[model samples]
Target: MGGSTSASPCSSYQPSPSTVPFQRPPSRFKDINKNHVRLDLNSMVSTLVSDLGSVDINLKKQRSGLLKKHRDSQYRLVELQLVVRFPCFTMTGTPPSLFTMPPRRRANSVRCGKATQVSGETHRVTEKNGNDSLDICRVLNGMWQTSGGWDRIDRDDAVEAMLRYADAGLSTFDMADHYGPAEDLYGIFINRVRQERPPEYLEKVRGLTKWVPPPVKMTSSFVRDSVNVSRKRMDVASLDMLQFHWWDYANTGYLDALKHLTDLKEGKIKTVALTNFDTERLQIILENEIPVVSNQVQHSIVDMRSQQKMAELCQLTGVKLITYGTVMGGLLSEKFLDTNLNIPFAGPPLNTPSLQKYKRMVDAWGGWSLFQALLQTLKGIATKHGVSIATRCR
Candidate 1:
């Protein structure tokens, strides 16, 4: 970040507003050609190529074990400042800075039209308008990094980290209703930014919260109460966005829930959205005229299932995709490039069931060897582009 470059907005490349129509390949997600839905996914290999408990044991150990050799000393694998890394990664062709081009604006990263990057692919999601948002760094500032398993996290430090990310113009946070104290932490973060940063800076940070209630015959009151609870927890009079996730697809009550969400959106409770919703469900929702602006899901190069019909539906419906697991829990980094990922769960603490769940997704996509090959290819691409594998291509 200290590297200096020409201090001017890059005019080198402008995305053809037409590129917004970029459609993903069909049959990329669930098309089964004799069970050969190989995505040729190119990123972290160690993640997909391992046993479970041991790879995770080192990462999941207590703090004492990581520091002390005491037999009883538990490794505080969770406490260590864990990082996501990839091997054989190098991307020199990237621009000196980052400017994401997203279709929405978040609340915390109030900076609109500001250039930001992870591996330096220039994108500007926020233009002069306040409605447009920036692409959240594919690798978000995971709160689970702090609050996931720790007995307690320092509130001030947590807030400071959030501010640092916001100050740097990285918005688009992915959180859920059940994450430990997540709503409260995000609320404090927003309040702190409002109190500390300039008014203009307050407009860029956008925090997206989720509502994963059990599938029920949702009532208007029920949905509104959920939205109201999040609003109170986030300390905001109006929510930037509220995504709903349903555990059961069979229950018809989901529609009722959405109707209430739509009402709340009209009432300024939130910018309505969905999470972990499959293409089929999304299509049904759209057909029913539910106005959703985005879909949060387990998307990554290795997991290209979304590229099939899901991405197309989004393109048609004007909803964008906020992808998590893009880096496969940091398994797409330099450290595991050529290494045999036969270890137990050597990965870091991934808070949501997503970490464990997605691992299964990877296995279904392809066995370990195929994943390794994919990472090698992405590594080659990253090296040519000039950025860290995790950032450049992760």
Candidate 2:
């Protein structure tokens, strides 16, 4: 799951909401310094994680059905959690300060790319396609960690983390059927939210789960059964979005699978999307009249493949792009910015699965020297803007 096989993009690097192009004002960068940027980065991450832990504790209690008798009382608890968490995540109406930047233009046009203001402070992406469209958070919490290549996660902790992310206005989540325990965790989180929060608040949360099945004979029974399994696991009557992926394009059954999914959209799914599909295949799917809203792909500064042909196809077909690998598995951050170039091979190995996977990408994208140069440029920009390199990348 860690290697690019997941074809996962980082949950960061969402499209900007502003219709007008953003040119960072020169005046804002005049007073920035490295110390200030470092402080802000450390403080921001620490505060987010710290506040999340407290909210997670409370959510764990609610998930355990401790507040069923006093549902009305639990509403205030939910509100408090949201109020505390929202400021940490959203960048609504903020000035061009060190920590805030306008949304970046994506390679492909994203539907509902604009952020809808809810309560003046919170922003959510509201797809403007009549009744079928959904309002979701731009930053979707990627759950591939549950799929593997990461540490073992306790079920309660994972569920609590989902609540933390949801309560923070990061309501949209990305998961797949193959990701072990991910759908189950969302099911638990959604059930807890439904039991504890009011309808309006619960509606703000969106789960964008995926259905990546093996290449097989696409029968109605087969497709329906697969969709039903996810529904049962997520404890939802209708899924917010189902992003389908196929391992082998040689098998033309993917079209049949999508047709069945489209049929089930009447009641089981709100939107149908694709994952890891190239331009030609995507065009073929659209030509067949399958209503795919978006295509998820591996997109980052390091990997600009999507911008070449996929962006044009997406622009023509009205399919928005949901990109991952935007942060290049954390390589675009400050930790590696000025490290020693010469080291014994195999002495300091790439530790995480993400690191190992993206290292290959770094090599292919002009090797270590050029990558280090890019990182240095990013560091300069971050220092100039008084923000972390990660913030700049996003």
**Each prediction's TM-score against the native?**
0.64, 0.68
lDDT of 1: 0.51
**Full-model lDDT for every candidate:** 0.51, 0.57
lDDT of 2 by residue, 1-394 (tens): 0111111222222221111112211211122211100000000010111111122122333223312223233211231121122221122111111011113332221222222322222344554222346566655678766655465667788788777766655677888776667788889889989988789878788888888676678899999988898898889999999988775667899999999999998999999887777677888888898888777766554554554456656655557667666676677778777664357552345666556667766655445665675666566556765666666212
- Model 1, 232-286: lDDT tens per residue? 8788888877878776667878788988887886554546777667777788888
RMSD of each: 16.9, 20.1
Error of 2 at 312 (Å): 0.9
Clashes of each: 54, 5
Residue 137 alpha-carbon offset, candidate 2, angstroms: 1.2
- Model 2 misplacement above 4 A: 1-122, 127-132, 340-349
Compared with the true structure, model 2 gives a TM-score of 0.68
